[model samples]
Target: MTTAIGNPYLEGNFAPVSDEVSVNDLPVTGTLPPELNGRYLRIGPSPKGSGETGMSHHWFVGQGMVHGVRLRDGHAEWYRNRFVRGDVPEDSPNTNILAHGGRLLALVEGGGAPVSITPDLNRMSTWDADGALRAGFTAHPKTDPATGEMHSLSYLIRPGTEELRYVVMDATGKATHAAELPVSGVPMVHDMAMTATRVVVLDLPVTLSMDAMGRLAAGAPESGDALPMRWNEEHPSRVGVLPRGGTADQIRWFDAPRCYVFHVLNAYDTPDGSIIMDVVRYDTVFRDVFRGPADGPPALARWTIAPDRGTVSEQIMSDYSVEWPRINQAWAGRSHRYGWFGGTGPDSLRLSDDVSRDRGGSFEPGPLVKFDTATGEASAHHFGTGRVTQEPTFVARPGAEAEDDGWILSVVYDGTADRSELVVLDAADLKAAPLARVHLPRRVPFGFHGNWIADNEIGA
Candidate 1:
């Protein structure tokens, strides 16, 4: 079926310009790229400047705006203020550009890396209330899940210096706390994940010694080593879990192997007790290098965290790589179960792969696989090629529903003029052809994250 909807803001090429000027002292804001506008949410990449090289300029400020879109028809009726903002230096193309949260809790991040914070977007603008930018804050803020309050952490990087000075802010975007996190002579923080009570940071320690061959030959090493490792001190892929209201001394440390870069973590209460789905990028290098069978595939691992016992058990899921997996909102208060396409091995497609290559590089969308937590059975759907699918978002059928029954919504990038289509799949039997395919006029730009807002709660 086909339907046409008009975007008033998008109608006359009337693009929203960045209120802030560029780092280059230019008055013009870069193009307002078109992206998927969602109900109570919107995610897109805001470039720093104009032209091809502008897109390559990683230092450009990237913006992610989440607002309320009409659920009945995909039209943005109202918008929450821009929550996630960061300067993407050319080298760090993998930073997070997406933020996902609800009316009460919103999580914002800079690229895919770890500056994850919860922010409140449904408030009266400070400018509307106070009459000045001076009354406002400069840093992008995230919300604290435990307290349901907003907070922000700002960092300063000086020329020829590696340390990052940070300032934390309250809900009103006012600086409430401040500190400096030494990049240890490194450029920036790699990735981070958080829970209600703790902030987990994945800092990559800069290395001066060892050439490419020397580092690869040495493989992975512990913290304080010269090799390129995941969470080590020299390459500090270390995890610092600090209590929400506590001091740095209360931070707990954990070690990740050379190839494992931590992704997202979700707290779960299993029959065995509380555990966490500690997702990490496995067997992938941040830098572009030789691609061959030697490269390992990404995978996810489950870790049992018993705070009282102060013990952790690392149990790897046998067939799943730490690569990207489609995660749905947990049902029945259960932990999240991810679905995606591709084999769990060294050859798995990763985001870092070259997109223009004939082989279609690593980030190419693969098959559909569903993971069952209760059975631990990874089910593959319609294996092999045909429909190229990337990240898949899920929507529960309106009403109290069965666990296995819901609609799985995803954008299928068909690689041609009719570039993409929104396909709905049977959540229980993903192998079934799409229940519906909603065609689009233009290809929706590749996005990082999305969520489903039901009809009733929207347009209220």
Candidate 2:
């Protein structure tokens, strides 16, 4: 029997044209070459989801050029267009685009090596010293700020068992080492994070008994019940930190819960040789599989490492309701402070005693919270009940910039009009009104990640 499926690509009334504007109905110029002097570069899949049989969704790299509007006296027009198209498949949720020195690195989802897009957004032709394709490949590549070297880790699933072997690569595209890791109940190696000096792998070692149709049969439901899943009295989560130059025996392991269902939203290195990782630890009894809330409002824990002494310390910075899970956090500045924003959800006061009755599910309007890392003092700025602000991208203003402050650019959802606006806030005082709100013609769909391209930069 054939089951009827709803069209996943249904169109909605999300796009809104800006008012106080004469060009009321400018058509969307799809997949066109970008103009020069554009400031922003965005990389994502083509509008159509990846379901077409033979054709692949075009991976787009777009540039936004800001121009003074002659029609609207004081306003400006930001023309965005795609400059490059690649057939790389983006099956995973996260893709990365980072500007390193003069070259742009594009990391697609599938198992290809990382691709290098030149300042012009065109794919580069040169291979690295190891003779690997420098462009149009896949791998998670992150550049070290101090040394400017690129590091990546890739893994392949073992043929007959639930295990994976990883290959670590350096800036010159050379495979430095290989090792095997047990995969219990966790997802594939597609979900991993890395720093300049270390690679962190999250794995679960429990085998799932399956039926004739290959569906999971009855087994222990909780991750903690998995035989090989690791947890300890202090950390209570399984984490493996492999140093870049260390031998297999020198690799360090820590216990930490899997916070999110199948992904690690963010992870970064700290100055004091610690790692801060965000995870969604499963709260089994309270979590609902179909319509239930997310697994956690995961906390950002500090994992301190003492290579010489062979020790690690895990400390939770802050934890909140599961409804308002904090996803991303960044160091604010010299004060050693950090600020983060929670996911969509209603105010805590509005949550009913019974969670099933709560209307909060996906992205509900939330607030931005700032914390003093040294003192653990925290404060929040809730935009409001109907207005949603999210995916804040913070940048330090150039020059002799304020050592303790930066600028935050976020997408604001104005519920009343069902439209979205770009809101810029002073990181120091988030409670203040946005410095500017550039009204958009439609809802910029919720996005995973973004980086700022300053105006004075060469490409812009």
Best by TM-score: 2
lDDT of 1 by residue, 149-186 (tens): 43333222322344332334344444455444444533
Q: On residues 359-416, what C-alpha lDDT tens digit does candidate 2 reach at each position?
A: 3323233566555555776556666656765456555644424433666655566667
User: Cα-based RMSD of the predictions, in order?
Assistant: 11.7, 9.2
Please report the candidate that would top lDDT against the real structure: 2
Candidate 2: regions farther than 4 A off: 1-38, 41-85, 88-94, 110-141, 155-186, 189-197, 204-237, 245-250, 261-293, 303-314, 321-336, 347-365, 400-404, 455-458
Reference-based lDDT, each prediction: 0.39, 0.40
Q: Distance from true position, residue 344, model 2, in Å?
A: 3.6
Candidate 1: stretches off by over 4 Å: 1-183, 186-191, 204-233, 260-262, 269-275, 290-296, 305-313, 318-362, 382-386, 401-405, 416-418, 453-460
